[model samples]
Target: MSESDLQDNNPLDPGDNSNLASGEGHSEDAPPFVPGLDGDPGSDQEEANNLEESTPVESDAFNAHVFEGQFEPNITSYQIIWQGSPNYWAGRGGNKIVAICDHIMQGSMESANSWFKNAASEVSAHFGVARDGRIYQWVRVENGAWTNGIMNRPDTSLPWLAEAIQKKINPNLLTIGIEHEGLTGQVFPEAQYQATLWLHRNLIQNYGIQPDRQHIIGHYQIDAVNRPGCPGTGFPWQRLLTDLGATQPKTTTLTSSSSSGGFLTGPVPGVVSGAFGPGTVNTNNAYVRSYPSFGAGVMVLRKLPAGTLLKFIAYTDQGAVYKGNSRWYLIDFTDKGGWIHSLMIS
Candidate 1:
């Protein structure tokens, strides 16, 4: 496949390259791989034997099989079906696979495999997860797949990410893409979620990646404008992050006396109380709900005008993402404490 084809066949957008641009202030040169522990020298061979033994005599619901082909770096314990088109290049010079990006196939596994395996598609990912939890490997972990398109512009919300984009380096060079079999907004099956969790854990352990949102990000976060709804908002981000032990502390103590009056007489049931911190409303007429989620049958206490300063006590994860914000903070408004969406506050 041609480079243009590879650049044009992103699953999120087939022909949008407005975000593609040459990076600045950094060499286009890839990094060098720093060899690390490969975990139990005999593990791969043993696993290969086990995999062969575990192969079913007949096809069943989980008709999983390994593709016994050569890997780019030739270092993976999992079964990989070589279905990648010859459109990718060697990964970041260091043979490094830093991030694990998730994507929705927007179709069944068959269609995903068909599209990625076809040379004309020019799009491919390192791994694919079927609805039945079957895992397929298309590209080698050490190679770059034309999965995540170039980020032509820097994401100001994540300044730390600018370095990678500024180098104009393809994220495929540093990340492994896992295409989950499904359509946008569809909840991932339990089997698929389990399989992905296993894959992610293995990848994290193998690559020494910090199990955090920064390292394991959804495609939507990477190219928010171009692919805002990718992997869908229904994706259980909190569950995945919690499983990876990446959740951060939500409580912060305040020293100012302005919040003392708002403190409740006793700890509220099901509510995590803490000292208040200063925050400002960023949106007009933001509602302060009695609960984190609007679906929780909680009452909307009041509305705070934009630019209203508030004291936040704690935060909760209600799996609600309003205007790109998933967190809700417990704040004091009108002398009554309520939960406010993070998007409405700076």
Candidate 2:
């Protein structure tokens, strides 16, 4: 669908968003989760230090993208500077920026489309217009997009996480930037929150990046040399790290798997055509989603590319029903549950 279609269907509408800031989205959407003790910042600090020390060595596998012009050249004019020895990649006085305009998702679907489109086109970053926990990707993660910037030189101590970023930024290249739907202060719905965390976890595991608070920074924390308070303080930074199992900062490499596997299986890959239905037969496709109506606690055990294998995690009556047939397979990935065509699975 085009960007307009996505905006028209923005999930931020009151009717679409039922879980605002309740931390119901992903297990990690909740805020201010104290992992150890309220005062034990030492352990956290040590962990952070260790992660930094163990930071992964940069690679040249990623391709960097050409950074577009400023977000609002005339309107935004901020300056950033760094402190301490030039050896460290840390800076001070920079904060995130928030747009006074209505939340990206609360406005017209067209607005959502434009916002994401503009973000992707105007800036070098991975942008998505997410609603009700569903996210639409506007940019690929393979290329280094200009999403993060240093207000000053010292905000970062290490060089780009990889060669792509090194040429452009000291660290932005290594980071996977994401934009969520909602106003600056508005709380994201539980479904959306869960989706964010799930997606984050998937990215972390897929990319093998260490899951940590340091690596996962909110837009608010970013400063444009002088501009500040972006993305607003409302972002649940702590909660996101906890839920995604990314607490340690400075970790360079992640050791986990992010693949969710296939939802449908067929004799050939990508052959599971048609919309999801009850007993419609599933062909191996990893993109299947289970309708949330079936409730939770359902899982799938299959691989992608069709003609692979089969296994069921937890069965539920949620998908593809025949003319009057009453058989469903519970499907739940990234949180928003849904049904699929049975015949599509095979």
Candidate 1 local lDDT, 176-262, one digit each (tens) = 888887766678888888878767766776667677766787775565544444576667677887887775445343333333233
- The candidate scoring highest on lDDT is 1
| TM-scores of all predicted structures | 0.55, 0.36
Per-residue lDDT tens digits of candidate 2, residues 126-239? Answer: 443355544443334443333444422111211222232344323333455565666545566676666566555545555555565335554322331111223444455557
Highest-scoring model, TM-score: 1
Residue 269 accuracy (lDDT) in model 1: 27
TM-score of 1: 0.55
Tell me the spans in candidate 1 whose CA falls farther than 4 Å from its real position: 1-80, 152-160, 247-346
- All models: lDDT? 0.55, 0.33
